[model samples]
Target: MGFSTDAIHAGQEPDPATGAVSVPIYQTSTYAQTELGRDKGFDYARSINPTRLALERSLAALEGGKSAFAFSSGMAAITTVMMLLKAGDHVISSANTYGGTYRLFVHIFQQFGISFSFVDTSRTEQIRHALRPETRLVYVETPTNPMMEITDLEAVVVICRERNLISVCDNTFMSPFLQRPLALGFDIVVHSTTKFINGHSDSVGGAIITARPEHGERIGFAQNSAGAILGPMDSFLVLRGIKTLGVRMQRHDANGRALAALLADHPRVGQVYYPGLPDHPGHEIAVRQMDGFGAMIALDLGSLEAARAFLNGLRIFTLAESLGGVESLACHPASMTHAAVPQEDRQRMGLTDGLARLSVGIEDLEDLEEDVERGLAAMKS
Candidate 1:
């Protein structure tokens, strides 16, 4: 089946017992057992839930992964994957990554005896140079958060294969609709379902999909043991939201590209960072890898003061930390998302104080352009 039809009907069937169309939320903590240590299909909620299983099955199929695991939040999913590594294992990650992920690598993982090195993954040579003898994994977020940096997945996969390193890609920005990293040779794909996958801004959840059964088993053990599984209600909501992902993504792509073009011509905008823009540094690579340019755009206002003014002036686009929701959001990555990374490191990656990351919504293009114009004008004022 094609993507749109799969989005709506995959892993979803009429309820066998009640004949209900929607997947019912199995909210109980524990399931009835016929004998000690023997339960019906589910032994406990932590081990599994019907609603979450439906979401997992659907997402796994969508991403072309062997298995899928859902978590309470994106960070939970990330932490679980990190747990698969031993204390002494080493990880090499893209320098321009989500702030929380950066902190996890720099601070939390270090305390556990694991070490990490950050490098620009877009440069294949830099990635090759950064790999150490102990490097167990190479983590990357293509069209990276805030900066819109594009890493060549095929190149990275070749390097990883040569070094026998696990390759993980965070697919939140483009979602599976725009890019499927697994198809490009990534071992694992992670998503913050609170974003595009959920679409409605109604749930905070995360998912990890892997092409290898061994990797899935390792992550699954950590997910169940750590107990960060998504609840049944949230799972059901996400599943419903994903049904319209194809339609919503089309609108998002249209609005994002239009906004990028508008901002590129605006006097107040110093620079626009979007894969859709032909002049963008990553445009060629993005065109080669992705089906669409995706719904995220970033603009530089030339100064922190101008950025603040623009964000405060926006009326329709809410100033928020999260992205990829149906409603538009504007975020200051220097302060909101990448604030945890040291100032020097952020500057090197082009996450300047004046950078404003916009998650273009499915709103009408005219309204969004007008709204952005207001912000641009305010920046000039």
Candidate 2:
């Protein structure tokens, strides 16, 4: 089946008992057992829930992976993937990454004896130089958070495969609609379903999908052991959100590209960073790997004062931290999402105080443009 059909029908069937079209939420914590050793499909919610299982299966199919595991949050999914590596193992990660992910690696993971080295994965030589003898994984977020910088997935995958290292890509920004990392030879794909997958911004969830059965097993073990699985209600919500993913993504791409074009031509904007832009450094790679340019865009306002003025002046775009919602949101990475990173390091990664990340919504093009214009005018004043 095609992507749209899969989005609507995959892992979703009319409830056999009630004939309901939507997947029913099984809210129980435990299932009834006929015998001490046996139960009816489920033993415990922590181990497995019918609703959550359906969502997982749907995501796995969408991403073209063998299996998928849903988590309480994006960090939970990431932590589970990290748990696959033991103490003394090292990870080579993209220098520009999600702030929360960076904190997990630099702070929390180190406490657990795991180490990491950050490098610009866009450059093959940089990635090669960052790898250590004990490196077990190459982690990256392409079209990286706030910056929208693209990494060459094919190059990184080849390098990791040759070095016997796991290749994991965060597909949150592009989601399954725009890019499928597994099909591009990535060993594992991760998503913060709180964003695009959920589409509506109503739930917080995450998932990990993998083509390899062993990798799935490792993540599954960690998921069950850690007991950070998504709740049945949240799972149902995510499933509902995913049903319209293809449709929503079409609008997101159109709005994002249109906004990026406008920002690039604006006089007040110092620079616009979006893979959809022809002049963008990673446009070619993005065209090769993704079906659409995606909904995320970043702009440099020239200074912190200008950024603050633009953000505060915008009436239509909400000033908030999260992205990928149906409603437009604008945030400063230096203060909102990537604040955890040291100011010096964030500057090095191009996440300056003047940087503004916008998640373009499905709003009308004219309205969005006018909203952005108002903000730009504020910066001038």
Candidate 3:
């Protein structure tokens, strides 16, 4: 079947006993065992839950990967991947990556002896020169958080393979429906299903899908041992959201294009960053690797005061922290998402005080554009 078909039906089947079309939430914490060791497939909820397993199966199929694992949040998925390394190991990651990921690397993992180098993975040469003998992984986020920067997955994967490093891609911005990094030779793909995957914005969840069974087994072990697995209810919600991903993505792409075009000509706008725009720095590569340019866009309003005026004037777009919802959202990366990163580092990554990230929604283009115009009008003051 196709991506949409597989999403709705891959691991999902009518309940054998009830014949319910939707996967019922198996809310039990434990399963009965015919023998001391085992009975059916499930023994405990933490190790495995039928609903979570179904969602994992869908994620695997969506990403064309060997196996998938669910976690409490996206950071949990990332932390599990970090566990794949130990003390004295080093990893190179995109400097424009998510703030939470940056915080985890610098404050949490660095204290444990693992080292990291923040470089422009979009410029492969930076990654090439950052390699150390201990470097075991190269992490990247195409259309990186806030900056909307694109990294060539094939190029980075080749570098990782040649150096015998694990290549992980944070595919949160471009969900599996838009781009599948595994097929492009990436070893692992991670996502915060809280956004696009669980499109409803009702649940907070995360997943790790590995291109190889070996990587899957390793991550599965961490999930089972650390026990940050998503609950049966949230897993069911995420599974429900996946069924409509194809349709939702279509609207997102359309809205993104409309908004980017309008903003490009707006008198108040500065540095519009949407990959779908022909003038965007990464437009050519995006056209090559992605099926759609997605709804996420970022821009600089020329100054922090101007950005505040625009943010305050928005009526339709919610001023919120998270994205990938049915409704539009606007956030300030310098203060909201990347606030934890030191000022100097955030500046180096191009997350300036004037930068505002917009998570354009599936709303009508006219309404969204009018709301954007409201923001621009506020800037006139």
Clashes of 3: 0
Clashes of 1: 0
Clashing pairs in 1: none
Give the Å shift of residue 60 in candidate 1. Answer: 0.1
Question: Tens digit of lDDT per residue, candidate 1, span 1-381?
Answer: 999888878777776769889999988998889998787788889999888999998999889899999999999989888987898898999999999999988888899999888999888788888878999999999989988999999999999999899999999999889999999999999999999999989999999999999999999889898999999999999999999999999999989988999899987798899999999888899999999998899999988999999999898899999999999999999999989999999989888999999999998889888898888778655
lDDT per residue, candidate 3, 1-381, as tens digits? 899999889888787759889988999999889988867988899998889998999999999999999999999999999989999999999998899999999999999999999999889899999999999999999989989999999999889999999999999998999999999999999999999999988999999999977888889998999999999999999999999999999899899889989998887898899999998888999999999999999998988999899999999999999999989999999999989889998888778899999999998889999999998898865
Each candidate structure's TM-score, on Cα atoms with residue i matched to residue i, is 0.98, 0.99, 0.99
Instruction: State the displacement of the C-alpha of residue 175, model 2, in Å, after optimal TM-score superposition.
Output: 0.5
Task: Flag regions of model 1 displaced more than 4 Å.
Answer: none
lDDT for 299 in candidate 2 is 96
**Distance from true location, Cα of 231 in model 3, Å:** 0.4
- Model 2 pairs in collision: none
Taken over the whole model, the C-alpha lDDT of each candidate is 0.91, 0.92, 0.92
Please estimate how well model 2 matches the true structure, expressed as its whole-model Cα lDDT. 0.92
